[model samples]
Target: ILTTLPRYPIPSDILTKQHVVHVQISKLPTDGVGLQLLELNDDFQFVMSELRQYYDEIKKLKPADEKAKRLHQNETFEGCCCLYAHFSENGMREFRRGIITGQSNGLAMVQDADFPWIGLVELRNLYQIPRHLVGIRQTCVYGVFGGFNMKTENERTLWDGICREMCRPGVRNVATFHRSAERIDYSGRK
Candidate 1:
């Protein structure tokens, strides 16, 4: 018999200097399990197209002019209320909806809508999102994946294993559930 449950500490390296984006849940996690999510693919695509056009317009401006424009935009927008272009690890970039949560020493801490991490982006990378695009709702909804009774030793071990795997660098974890069938796969990024 267990007297109390053990609390596991989140790995600091996994989310160092990052802030988790808060999302509203229609129902609490304790209400049920295996909840399915429907993403608005068409709307997401439309927003990406619009962002591309915005980026192109910025590119046309002179380097000094562009820097000034971005600085001005950063000062005007509120935190977590606008979209921004975040460059990927491969040098390619993707437009993610984020808000400037904080700034210091010319770097802005951005909380991306879909990602589980906050990005410390350079001020030059920030751009002004068009007003029309800012009002579009987020396309994806985030959720808690599992509900475990931490008092049980077996469940605690299982949860620990899952956390460790998710913390690994360059490994993308994909979880897909349909009609009660669940699949989880991990693939390494190049």
Candidate 2:
């Protein structure tokens, strides 16, 4: 559906005016289910209103105080995103270099690229390669954030599996690839 411009909680005048209209599927007598939602519209604000409501909920979760405010300001959750990638291999390589050289943060690097590729790195059991993709090689290497300390085995397993799977499929296409930087953002919230 068409969504309106985004509004954060701090902007009361603009944020309060917008309401999120959610359309859900319902089981009908004949039809098994139905899909419904407001048409995508640029004029109607959508995600921003919902984010504000979520922000309010998060704020209320803790005791009101300076500590709470601080927590709210820095807290990270699934919905409370900082940044991530959705781009290409060359783009990811550039991003990795920037981060290693203190030129960018993980979030900023991923978001900066036109299509963030590191997003696929999040997959645990399976490998995700862009099917029917053009350009790029299969042997390209990628490093996941917090690889050794947090999840040494799972991380290695994922990489190895991806390598094996890609070789089998004969799809040597790396959309996003990068090396690890020394400085790390432990929180992974952003």
lDDT of each candidate versus the true structure: 0.49, 0.25
lDDT of 2 at 61: 66
State the lDDT of candidate 2 residue by residue for 16-134, as single tens digits.
23322221221211111111112222212333343344445544664444133221222222222222223333454111100111111212222111111223222111111122211
Q: After superposition, how far is residue 66 of candidate 2 from its true place, in Å?
A: 13
TM-score for each predicted model, relative to the true structure: 0.51, 0.18
Cα shift from native, residue 103, model 1 (Å): 1.7
| Candidate 2 whole-model C-alpha lDDT, 0 to 1 | 0.25
Q: Give the TM-score of candidate 1.
A: 0.51
lDDT of 1 by residue, 1-190 (tens): 0000011122233223322222222232322222111234456578778877877877799988777656553353446455466745356776666667677766777765533235677766777667777665554433345466566788768766765665465545443321221221112211
After superposition, the stretches of candidate 2 with alpha carbons farther than 4 Å from their true spots are 1-44, 63-190
Candidate 1 global lDDT = 0.49
Who wins the lDDT comparison? Answer: 1
